[model samples]
Target: MSIVDTSQKQRGRGVLEGAFQVLDALSRFPDGAGLSQLSRACELPKATTFRLLEQLVELGAVQRHGTEYSVGHLMARLGENWQPHPRLRRASRGPIRTLARLSTAAIAVTILDGDRVRVVGATRGTPGELPHVMADSASVSRTAAGQVLLASQPRRERPEAYTATEWRRLRSRLRQDDAVVVEYEDVLPGVCCVAAPAPLPDGQGVASVSALIIGSTVPSALPGLVLRAAGEISRGLAVH
Candidate 1:
C-alpha cells in the first residue's frame, strides 16, 4: 500500500480508539461528568476529549446535559439487546427467581466477559429492598461466581488475582468440589455468597449461579439450593 494510504488507515484506527477511551471513561460516571473530568479520566488532551465527546454526542452514544455528559439512550438500548449467550440467560432466569424466593436472598447469573465477570441476570429486590451486591461487572478474584468461572480457566489464562501457588490450589479445590462460598466483611459486612457452575452438555462450565445472602450466618442448605439451581440451568441448556 502507499504510505499515504497506510498513514490514513493508522489515523482512522487512532480516532476509533480515542473515541472508545472517552466512552469507557464516561461509563464510570453514571451521573455524568464535566468536560474536564472526562478529559482527565481518559488521559487525553482537553481538545481531543472534547472533540471526541462532541462526535459521540452527535452519534447518540453519549448525552450532554448543559455542561455534563453521560452515556446515552442509544447505548442503553444496545446493551439491553446484547445477548452474548441467549440460551444461558433465558434458562437461568426461572431458576434464579426460584432460588431467590426459596433462599430469600438475591441471586445472580454470571459469565466470564473478557477479564471480568458480567452479571447476565439477577434478582431485582428482596423483601425489604436490600441493595444488590453484584454490579454489572465484578472482579474475577473477589466474587464467588467469578471464582467458579476462573477455576475453569487454565492457569496461564487466569487473571493475576492470586499468587501462582495459591491460584493452583484454589483452582484444584474448586474443580473437585464444584462449588464455592465466600463471606464478605469489609465490602458488605453482613453478606455471604454461594456459587456453583452451570455446565453445558459437554461438561464445560459456561456460567455460574450465585446467591447473595444478607446476614452473618449462611444457612447450611443455601449452598445446596444454589447447586440445584445451577443444575437446572445446565439441564435447560442441554435441552436447547
Candidate 2:
C-alpha cells in the first residue's frame, strides 16, 4: 500500500507553529520586540521570523513600532468584540449584570476601537426605557468602565492630539490614573456612570465595564458593585 504524503500536513502545522512562536516572542516584551529578539525567542531564522511578523502586522494583530512590534490595541478590540473564549464573558458579564441589578441600572461593556472606544455589549435594567447609546466610535459619557479602563492605562499615553472639542470631551472624562468616568457625554442621558478597567494577562485592560444608574438612583451601592466586578475580571484574567 502506498503511504499518504505527510508533507502537506506538516506544512500546515508549520504555519501555525511559526505564528504562535511569533506571538509568544512578542508577548515577552509588552513594550514591543525587535526582529532579532523575536527570531532568537522563537528559535527561528531571522528571515522566517520577519516573514511571520510582517503577516501578523498586516493583519492588525501586531503593530510594528520602528524596528519593534507590540501587541496592537486593534487585536484587543477584536478579542473583546468576539472572543471565542468563554472565560472572559464568564468572568465579566455575570458581574456586570450583578451590578446593574443591584442598582437597577444599565450596564455597558466597551473596548477601545482605534481612535475611540465602542460599545460591544449592554444590558438595560428596565423595559421601554433604553439606556443612552450613541453611534459607534463616538465619545461616550464618562462611566465606571471608562474610568477604570482609562485609569488602567499608562499615565504617559497622550489624549492631547484630539481636536479642541474632542480634547475637552476626553479630558472631561479623565480621572485619577487617566481614568475617564464621564457624565452623559453622549450616551445614556440622565444616567451617571462609574467605570473601571477589566485587567488582562499582560497588565493590559481588556475592556471597560461601567454601570449607568439612573441619575435619581442612590449611588450608595453603585461604586462598590462596579469595583467588585472590576476586581473579579482582574482576578479572572490574572492568568492571561
Candidate 3:
C-alpha cells in the first residue's frame, strides 16, 4: 500500500482497538461509567476516549446520559452475550440470599473490576438492615469486600492495584488469613462485616462474599457462616 494509505490503515486499527477497549471497560460497569472513569479503566487518554465515545454515541453503539455512558439500544439489540458478571450474579444469588437469611445480616458478592470492587449480588437480612457496608462499586481499599478481593490478587499487584492510602490501611488492618476478615463499624458506624474470598475450581479467587451485620460488634458465628457461604458461591461460579 502507499505510504498515506498505510498510515490511514494504522490509524484505523488503533481506533478499532481503542473502541473495543472502551466497550470492554463499559461492560464492567453495569450501571454506567463517566468519561474519566472509562478513560482510566481502558487506559486511554481522556481526549481519545471522549472522541471515540462521541462517535459511538452517534452510531447508537453507546448511550450517553448527561455525564454517564452505557451500552446503547442498538448495542443491546445486537445481542452480544457471554457476560461473566451477570452469570456470576445469577450463580451466586441463591447462596448470597441464603447467607443473608442465615446470618440475619446483609450479604454481598463482589469482584475486582480494575481498581474497584463491583457488588454483583446482594441480599438484605431478615431483621431488615440496609447494606451500607457493601455499597455498589466501592473502592477496594475502603471496604472489607475490597480487601478480600485485593488479598486474592498476587502480592506484587496489590500495591498499585488500589488507592495507595486505603491499600496501606487495609494491608495493615487485615490479618493474613485465608478464612475471613472481620471489621467492626469501619466502613460505617453501627455496621460490622466479615469477608472471605470465594475460591474458584482453578484455585484462583473469583470474588468476595461478605456478611454485613447492623451491630456494634462482629457476631461470633458470622465469620464461619460467611466463609462457608463464600465457598458455596465459589463452587457455583466454578462449575458455571
Candidate 4:
C-alpha cells in the first residue's frame, strides 16, 4: 500500500482498539458510568473517550443518559446470539445450583479466556452474599477459579503473578490435590473460595467450579464439596 494509505490503516486500527477498550470498560459498569470514570478505566484521554462514546452511541452499541453512559440495546441484541461455551454452561447449571444450595456458598463455573477468566454460569447461595468477582469477567491472577485453570496451562502461558518456583510448587499441589483454596482480602475482606478443575472426556482440564465462602470461617468440607461439583460437571460434559 502507499505510505498515506498505510498511515490511514494504522490510524483506523488504533481507533478500533480504543473503541473496543471503551466498550470493555463500559461493561464493568452495568448501571452506568460517567465520562471521567470511563476515561480513567480505559486509560484514554477524556476527549478521545468522549469521541469514541459518541460514535458508539451513534451506532447504538452504547446509550447515554445526561452525563452517564451504559451498554445499549443493540449490544444486548448482539450478545444474545453469542454463546461462548454452550455445552459447558448447560452441563454445569445443575451442579452449580446444587452446590450453592448444599454449601450455602456462591458457586461459579469459569473458563479461561486468554489472560482472564470468564464466569460462564453462577448461582448465589443466599440473597445478597454474591462476590463482585462472580461477575462476567475477572483477572486470572485474582481468583481461585483462575488459579485452577492456570495450573492446567503450560508454564509459559501462566501469568507472572507467581514466581517460577512458586508456580511450579503451587501447580503441582493444585493438580495433585485436585483443588485450590484462597482468601481474597482485596476483592472482598473475609471471603474465601475453593476451586477445582472440571475435566473433559479426554481428561483435559478446560474449566473450573468455584465456591465462594462469604464469612470468616471457611467450612473444612468446602474444598471437597467444590471438587465433587467439578467432578459432576465434568461427567455431565463427558456425556453432552
Number of the top candidate by lDDT?
4
Best by TM-score: 1
Score candidate 2 by lDDT: 0.63
The parts of candidate 2 lying over 4 Å away from their true place are 1-81, 84-86, 116-121, 124-138, 141-144, 155-157, 160-188, 216-218
- Provide the overall lDDT of each model, using Cα atoms, as 2-decimal numbers: 0.77, 0.63, 0.74, 0.78
Q: 40-152, model 3: which lDDT tens digit per residue?
A: 99999999999999999999999999999998987777654423377678778888778878788877877765554556777742211233333234433446776677755
Residue-level lDDT tens digits of model 1 in 1-240:
699999999999999999999989988898999999999999999999999999999999999999999999889888767765678878988999899899998888877655545667789731121123332233435567666777666543544656668667767866764455454642466777778888755744568788887887789888889988998998889887
Which 10 successive residues of model 1 have the least lDDT summed?
126-135
lDDT of 1: 0.77
Q: Best to worst by TM-score, what's the order?
A: 1, 4, 3, 2
Q: Score every model by TM-score.
A: 0.62, 0.46, 0.60, 0.61
Clash counts per candidate, in order, are 0, 21, 0, 0
RMSD, one per candidate, in order: 6.0, 12.8, 7.7, 7.1
Candidate ranking (lDDT, best to worst) = 4, 1, 3, 2
Error of 4 at 172 (Å): 0.7
